[model samples]
Target: MSEQTTYEFHVAAQGDVLEQYITARGRNTFIMGPIGSGKTYGSAMRVFDQMCEQAPNSFGVRKSRFVAVRNTYPDLKGTTIKDWCDLYHNEDCQLGKFNQDFPPTHYLDFDLEDGTRVKAELVFLALDRPDAVRKLRGLQVTGFWLNEVKELSKAIVDMCDGRHGRYPSAAEGGPSWHGMIGDTNAPDDDHWYYELAEESHPEGWLFLRQPGGVIEVTVGKGEHAVTKWIANPNAENLANLPDGYYINQVQGKADDWIKINLANQYGTVATGQPIYKGQWNDVLHINNNKLLPIKSHGDLLIGFDFGRTPAAIIGHLTPLGKLRVLREYVSENMGVRSFMDFLVPELKREFPAYSKADMQAFCDPSGWGKSGNDENSPIEIINMEYGITAYATTSNKPENRWEAVRFFLTKKIDNQCAFEMSADCKTLRKGFNGGYQLRRIQVAGDARYTSVADKNKYSHPHDALQYLAQGAQGEVDYERTEQLRQTSEQTAAADSLTGY
Candidate 1:
């Protein structure tokens, strides 16, 4: 009789959730946890298990295909691809070079027990841009694994589902197991993943969340101190980490960073002093009372900021003497013509009640220079081509325009803000919440602060808004203007009758 040989290896569960995660059955499975929680390792192990589960055909080959995806090419190469290679270090697998052919493919040809052959082609993809969805088209995959899914949009997740469970060909008896698996750290509450996991809880979807680690630090006399890292009860993979790993990581970090990276909480963190500190509050500024519909009669006041990254804001003067910003449009790497193309359609769609004749535009005074393409100023393009007469702000000084916006942000009437932006205006909301902030300059051999807000992503939208605020600050209220006009007309009629 021939001697038999058995090869045995152990796969230890890193945490309470890892074992359950490896065997969980679902159309879509998500493993979410804090840093160093082994979410990626658990997800990759599941993918390997599914590849091995492919039943052999008549030719004795277990054929399968999977795609390991990330938000960008650099992340794919640097993170997911490395984690995948590490997962199968002991297996008799050969990893092929990343082929640059159309629909790029990476291969991992290996063998299983009982002389069963496995050919698992692993394709790596990056879905970074809006147009990146095109790459997922026409792909037939047994399943897919998305790493750091917080960086990806929900559209990419939906597209992956549509492409999965169709690989290895039906003629080859189809896949034994096929579905999508993903791993992520805590993302913002507004992200779609939060909705899927926290709100929707769709059928055939399994979400496993690991608890965050806690660190407490105490200082003693003479600069001595004691610190403790308490692993959350639900945290996993503690055996793999060094002593005090979680505690050391959070030392001297900001509260927001600690909350996100260590506590695994979802909240906003400001890198510096928020420009609209004490002026804007999410609960107060974004209430329904502040976001009411616009009245139909007043001119649609528009503020324009001109540059390679052009932006515009459309607002109207409320009867209560406040500025209600209704719509905002922003784009980068576009000229005035393209910007107008985007803005004009949006304006017509959002404010169908208002016509071009009822629109009044205000632009940055600096745009009056003949430095643009075709030697025509932005003001010239707006008036001549678009047929909407535009005027530049009276002052181009940054502080003057900033003060104009600050007046609206700070000076309230009857305990209400004088200015409010629609909640749908995300870019502008970011601006009010520290996106438009002063650049912190570190002085040599001293600790002093500078109050100069640097121009950045938030600058253009805020600049656009400043034009509206500064221009409208000196504007006559439509209701007041109409009342004065009527009073003058009535007096003129009485005078005419007396003269006759």
Candidate 2:
């Protein structure tokens, strides 16, 4: 409908304000909508149409340059690039692979037919490398299309805008440079992209928000701006998308529904909103991980995420309600007994304040708890050897646990938390380096998120995050946690009650 129709629609008029506002825009503007809702098609049509019109003076050889960016190469190749190549490249207009054929791994370039060619440089970046987006230097970028702006951060937007300054604007008579587009639907309020950009540009920015089939364009968040909001045509303007794209994007996915699908924001569709979208940014630093000593705010607590390979760990707690994290102990092929022994001494050395009395320890209840098949748990053995009282905490409800971690993540604990880099935990860290990304589901469902799952065959990290969150909520009973059975036995008078 709207998608295919836009291709044939002819507006011979030059620089329609709407088209020009879209074409000449040099600032970061998000074009977010449901999966198919003409997002890919709308962007492609506007860019190609106006660009061809501008290339009248070009030589017989078509040459144009644009950057089609995504979180990774496959996303670019399989989605954005493919869409562009299939939709725009016609016979008279050739799509050629010059000497440089950037494998669709992340992003690539293409030479079009008109004297003007289109160069598509795909960049797969994570938020942790805020500077990574800055690397688009030197390349003469005629236009940039960030396919999934929802997964990107404000830092990246800033970098793209900042770097283009080198290109002289029309005022200087040298080819004046302008940005082609910025687009994403709605993301969580806590999302950095929303916080740093949306909050700041409420009225001054061009915002297109869709509550359902209807799309509204707001000049800014100001009262005057809100009055000027316009609804985009849903029939021919947005009809060509597969019927179920919107349904799959905002409702059925296992994650955020209202903001992403209905409101057209970009973010994880987590119903529980488990890890902060920023966790993506944090995990990106996994490659050059350097342990930053945590500043002690509260009694630091550690949670074990046991794996058959390198066992993962997270140590954090509010000693006196002040947040603090010791080091993260991650290792591979280490036995339970050795881990307990090794970690105890290591914890003692790092957090000297956690003396024999003030310590609280928690591990997954599913495996090796005292009542389980395994006789000695890592916690129990650690206590027997170090004389440090360790608490065996049962996990909190799954949804509740994810919420607890979110509370901490949303709070201001400037000096409280710290992440240390370890050779083994690099994979986990990489998972956190990027912001959570939401994709359009083919089934017409709500949003689904892609992030680091368990490195092990059994994706237990999801479970471990639940375990770690239990302690964060301060629900642990230091003494009575694992002692539930022992206390019950001591109090039970089975011999007398049984009429023996």
TM-score versus the correct structure, for each prediction: 0.50, 0.39
lDDT of 2 by residue, 1-500 (tens): 01111123343312232243345454444554544455665566655643444332233222234555666666665777677766544444343332224433222233334324332333322323576644465655555666667766666765665443232233333233446465565565456654444334443345444333422233432224331112333422344455544434444433344334543444432332233342222312222333333545444555656545324354555443432333455556777666666777776786576665655555565434553476665565555545554454455454455455544543444553322233234333322322221322344565454333323322344344445556656555565544744554454657568864
Best by TM-score: 1
lDDT by residue for model 1 (17-130), tens: 777887886778887777887888888888877777788877887888998888888788787877776765434433334564644566655555577766777788898765
Measured with C-alpha atoms, the lDDT of residue 31 in candidate 1 is 79
TM-score, structure 2 vs. true:
0.39
Query: Which regions of candidate 1 are displaced past 4 Å?
Result: 1-9, 89-105, 215-229, 268-500
lDDT of 1 at 210: 68
The 0-to-1 C-alpha lDDT of every candidate, in the order given, reads 0.72, 0.45
Lowest summed lDDT across 10 adjacent residues in model 2 is found at 1-10
